[model samples]
Target chain A: MNLSKKSKVFIYILLTAAAIYFLAPFAYMFFSTFKSEAEAIAYPPKFFPSQWHPENFIKAWTSQPFGTYLWNSILVTVLTTAGQVISCSLVAYGFARYEFKGKNILFMILLSTMMIPWDVTMIPQYMEFNLFGWINTLKPLIVPAWFGSAYYIFLMRQFLMGVPKDFEEAARIDGANAFQIYWKIFMPILKPSLILVGVLNMITVWNDYLGPLIFLQDRSKYTLALGLASFKGVHSTQIVPMLCITVVMIIPPIIIFIIAQKYIVEGTSGSIK
Target chain B: MNRKKFFRTATPYFFILPWVIGFLVFTIGPLIFSLIMSFFDWPLTADPKFIGLGNYIEMFTEDDQFRKSLVISLKYAAIFVPLNMIIALFLAMLITQPVRGVKVYRTIFYIPAVISGVAVSIIWGWILNSDYGILNYLLSLLGIEGPRWLVDPAWALMAVILASAFGVGTMMLIFYTDIKNISIDIYEAASLDGASVSKQFFSITLPMITPTILFNLITSIISSFQQVTLVMLLTGGGPLNSTYFYGLYTYNNAFKHHKMGYASANAWVMFIIILLLTALVFRSSSAWVFYETEAKNSGAKKKRKGGKEA
Candidate 1:
């Protein structure tokens, strides 16, 4: 654990350089949002805007119906997170608690399902959703999470497996049924896993482009990701507005990441270990 | 069995019923349906007409874009996988060093991983802009003129890869955790033996985390094949279809071109390719992947066998 001063200084310098490499793009984007179209594309690109333009954010927001996109993003993200937490927990609790027929085989099937690429099922799933008239609505995106994804269920199961059986047994002895035990006893115990799944799901759902792109037809129903993508085609020449919108689009996930970073980092590290 | 016994047996099923139903309807059902659809020209506006293996034939013989996209994707994977792995491992090592304020550096480095796909592509699109980008400016400062990054066909795929390389935080964290799990005694012993840090890394740390490295390798390869959102958003298959990735090709065929049946066939081909590649990686893993527990378990088994023989 002991390090000479020279080595420590060298390490710090390398680390700081890498950090700057990672963060410089965001700082560039942040500054570019304030630049005028000409300044944004000037021959010698300016790192700092000569004039501040705080209203660019508003222009970008109002240029399209970004309010609707923001609303749709929030709606889908929250509902899917809630749905995954509830449904995956119940399924994970069942798998973790019970010794049932075909348990190992079923668990294997679940894990195998995770390996199936979204492309393979994407076409037929689109057809099926069309059959249900769920296309163009948020139903296709939101409804599936209500059933539980294999990864989240696996994570919850792993977390639950580490907890002792004494709590469930005591609850059962107190005349609590299976559902009651799951609700009262296990839900509290599984809160960390739930938060981990929820936050992860929120980031994914918020940022999901392909899902909304395929299913949703109307521009009004577009998620933030889909909406931001549309800017590329329509406003391709307007670099300032595009940069402003890009900045606007990224803030929510960055905020959530900053706030719940511990859970996200620890959750990933825990799963890997 | 009696009613109470039946209830006890079915209770777990009841709890798991939602996932079972979802799996069948959403996952298994679609998988089978897509397989069947791949055989026929299943149109969006018309009834299903079976044309048995016609779609697959067309993909192999008739589709030029499909072949190009496939090659582009393979090239992207070839470059991105090793490059991303090295960067991730290097960053992981940097952050794990005995340095002050390591957490802040880790957070800053990981910020890109949290940013949305669309945002990442857009930011990078601007950064890699031919005339006005910071990257070109930086290069010009060094007396080297930068290529038109996203605009030039020669550099478009590389641009996409460089953009994606920013988001290697997840893989880096995995390596960091595995490195953290390594017992410090090994490193101490290596130091005592006058081994350099680089020597210690290759002989001790690298061998210890081969399993994690394998896991990252397989997942990254599979995901690189599945890459779409960035290409779709940033390049849109780009000038002269240079950055036209396989996933984007399939997406365009299905949604843009409305060749759903053909796209299904394309997807199936990709699925098989992924499976085969995954199998190949796994098959090769036995040679390189080191499991400490497996060694110990086998050692114990050998001792027991020797004792019985004696």
Candidate 2:
């Protein structure tokens, strides 16, 4: 494509302006973390702090049991990511490779389930969890992912459908059973899709506020998101600490997104395409 | 033959058993149970009592908050869907242009989407503060006083909408991908015919990407109706209940107030509405959404690809 020099400059300026628009809020929050509480809320809202305070991160961490919150978040994120990958892979493999009665109907049903609003099932699931003595623990958040969500199942199925059948047939000729072929051949080949699923799940589980808010009432069991939200409600006036903790809370997902961004962007396009 | 067929089918079921069991126990069972529970006066601590249509009748007739919440959410969807679609399409087009550091800008835009829910709400809470906020301060520079964003009832919904719109990154990326897939030859042909860039965009690009537009529209609509976490964290449906979204109402009813039956009834109504809306979108899409491969009804492209492989 050819562009006039004037048009090229225009495109660059427009893009730079958009970049700032999208990034300004996060950048402001980052700078506010270094400001004193009063300065953070001072009139004419300072974009840069007069005096930098790096200790706010430490102060915020000690203000609550953020250590426990971090642990809970890591536990739920790791377990759910693993569970979703394994379960969704198994299910996707079943659908991708096999020709069986009711296959089309089952796949259609799985797709339809993605449209069911989470609110519709929240009441009964809460009741069911309460009955099983699962509320207030990480069980409610962790256990469900082991069953495979509809969206992840759909994504994995789309990926696996494009994999050629020759490898599975060759493995079968070598006396490999269905599970063996899945374990050895397909699992290795599905690494990119698995990473896609893992990164997506990690971001979601790491940043989930509502699931932890409803199920885990105890602060000791609170995920980072829930803990930070509780902090916001209680310490509404403490801007520095709140902003500092907000920065800490968002670091993991941002880092993960940056590292695995190619898989996320390209894989999403591939799925929809 | 019967035994052989049983084994053939049973193997796949064995692999899929976890999901099957999960679907039954988790999704289907709860869906039915919630439906049944909606017809009762079920409390958390007390035994459930049968009251057929009672909760529904009360929600429709007596519950003013219920009606308000529904309208508020619908209003939110009304603003959010169109705004999101336009912004997403614009950004997608912007990034797809062959400019310097485009990938970096794409990542920057998507960063907000990855850091969602509580963190986003808290960030926006500070920005939308009436007196001390950067936004209001910026407004003052132009000699225009800004309204109290999250605090004022009149602007709270708009504040929430602005906050949520930051996540248009995902939609933008999807559109970007679809737009990138358009064959360059068509644009070249349009250029030969002396078509302007804007003209080519509307006449060629927009028509081709209509299928993706439809996909994003339905998904955004469904998710917009199901929005809760942001509202709960940002405003908590406060300032005269201006931002009392339907999802938050259902949550508060079941969890805060412990009116399980009534909440279930609220949820059921929401579910039906979503289904109807989705069906409506799908019904309307046939008129606009064009499938290039199917609508063309030619295998010329398919044959070319086949020739390459052979």
Candidate 3:
């Protein structure tokens, strides 16, 4: 459709205004991280720091056991991503390709599982984890993903269902077993969906706070999100270091998002359609 | 049965065994256990005393916080769900325009959503700080005295709403994808028929995307109710328990107060409310939500000369 010049100008102005609202906070936080604490919170807040203090990142990183928190976060994120990709793919393939008696019911059960809010199940999960002596360890966060989640399984199933019915017939006729076909043939074909699952899982697990907040007691076991939140309690008056840490904490997910924007967009649109 | 036949019969279940095991151990078991715990007066560190319907009765008749938190969550959802959807739909429309540099605008709008809730709360906390915050400082430049955003009970919910709105880009992207999937030929046809842009939107674009709108509506309702992290970190339920959201109330009850039995009752109440709301919305949706297949079948006969296939 064609638009008049005046309306196009109006559109540009509106777009620019929305962009500023979205980007201003990050810009402010990034610039403020380089300032001294006093200037960071001055009455007339400055957009840019008078002097650059690049060492503030170092100070924030060492203010707590952030290094350990970073490591724990990496452990959970990597393991969960790997677990979710593999497990979700297998489950989705079964639902998509197989014909069985209970398949419809089981698949419906999987879909309905997405509606169960975490509040209803978390208390018992806490107790169960405690019973297993898995509390405070990474097991509560990591082990569950190996079993596959409903949303990811649903997404992978959507992708897999789009493949032709006879896509696996040649491999079956060539004497390949089911597991072998899944591993060698389907896995390669499911690469983009796998990356999509891995990326989504990685971002969620990396940023998860409530899990670590509840299960982990010792500071040594804290994830980055938990550590970042601990700053609100311990360093409530210290704004610069908190802002510095917040900036540092957001870097990984932002980088991952930028790199995998294509798959994320495609995967989301695929599921909804 | 022979070994090979048995294996063939069990093959699909084997492929899906991980989820089956997960569903039983992680989901179903916990659900049933939680339900049972609601009936018992379970303490954090001691043996639970079985008291049938006691916790539920106490919640309905006794606890003021239960009612207050429920109202707060409902109030938040009532204001939040519609406001956020409007902004998301508006932004989605904006970014879908055939203008230069809209891609950069799209990325900018979505960047806030990629940041974690923890970081978002912290950033907003500092920015909304009354004395030293930039927002008020900027307001002072305009000779307007900004309200104490996080400290005042009246404004705290609004502050929470403001911070939460930063993440509207996810919903916007969902809407954008659905809108983009719409064929441009329909819009062109409408344009040739002398329909204005706004008319085309209401008649064509809006009706075409009701399915996505319904999807966003349900998901956002669920999320608005489950809002815990932001309220926990940002306001900590505020100066006057003004923003003591039901989710945070439940979290604090179970974790902070260690009233495991009572929190279970609280969780069950919220579960029922959400289920009811979702069912209601679904029941109402048949009247509003239009699918492509339905449009294809009856749209030409009913009305709208152009864009009949949407």
> Model 1, residue A160: what's the lDDT?
87
Query: lDDT per residue, candidate 3, A110-224, as tens digits?
Result: 9888877788999999999999999989999999999999999999999889989998999999999999989998999899999989998998898888999999999999999
Best-to-worst order by lDDT is 3, 2, 1
> Candidate 1 vs candidate 2: which has greater TM-score?
1
Docking quality (DockQ) of candidate 2: 0.81
Residue pairs whose backbone atoms clash in candidate 2: none
DockQ winner between 1 and 2, please give it: 2
Candidate 1: give the TM-score of chain A: 0.98
Assess each prediction's global lDDT (C-alpha) against the native: 0.90, 0.91, 0.92
Q: Residue B96 error for model 2, in Å?
A: 0.4
Q: Output the better candidate (1/2) by lDDT.
A: 2
Cα lDDT of model 3 by residue, B1-310, tens digit:
6999999988989999999999999999999999999999999989999999999999989999999999999999999999999999999999999988887788888888888999999999999999888899888899999999999999999999999999998899899888989999999998999999899899999999999999999999999999999999999998699999999999998998888988888898999999999999999999999999977768666666555656
List TM-score per model, in order: 0.98, 0.97, 0.97
Question: lDDT of model 1 at residue B134?
Answer: 82
Off by over 4 Å in 2: B1-6, B298-310
Q: What does DockQ give for each predicted structure?
A: 0.80, 0.81, 0.81
